[model samples]
Target: MAKISLRPLDDRVVVQPQEAEEMTAGGIVLPDAAREKPLRGTIVAVGPGKMLDSGNRGELTVAVGDTVIYGRYGGSDIEVDGKEMKILRESDILAKVL
Candidate 1:
């Protein structure tokens, strides 16, 4: 994949969402409108850590190339270089796939 040009500020990150499943477990093909939004993605770009009151930047646990699960309704969806991506705050990310 081509590299994304966006740089998120603070505790935000850029994620390339995984495509929604095209078929059901029962072998039924799903139409676009019937497919659920994907809740998992791979991190592409990460922002600098959020500033802290102690005159130091707080460290972020996640990093680029991490596969993470996020909330279904979290983050802003955008298109970068004709590719769909999500920009989410660090808080929006739920868990990292080990």
Candidate 2:
């Protein structure tokens, strides 16, 4: 298995998307293309906070090692240290995994 580390800056977050399950309903084993991209991810790193219009930094809601669910069209994909990772602005994350 491959692993990665990231340090985001200025209201950004480093996330690794969680892979979807291999099986489907009615006992069907689905292939990679038959599944939808998971919108969830693990929070690898978080930025300081959002910069306010007055230059004040807001509080951050997400933390490192937290599992999260993000938006479909959000985040920028990149390969870091030979592994895939996503660099997302904090606002792009939709919710945290329970």
Once fitted onto the true fold, the runs of candidate 2 whose alpha carbons sit more than 4 angstroms away are: 1-5
Q: Candidate 1: minimum summed lDDT over ten consecutive residues — where?
A: 1-10
State the lDDT of candidate 2 residue by residue for 33-86, as single tens digits.
888877898887788888889989988888988898888889899888866789
TM-score of model 2 vs. true structure: 0.83
TM-score, one value per model = 0.96, 0.83
Whole-model lDDT values for every prediction: 0.95, 0.83
Candidate 2 local lDDT, residue 6:
60
Question: What lDDT is obtained when candidate 1 is compared to the true structure?
Answer: 0.95
Error of 2 at 22 (Å): 1.2
Number of backbone-clashing residue pairs for each candidate, in the order shown: 0, 0
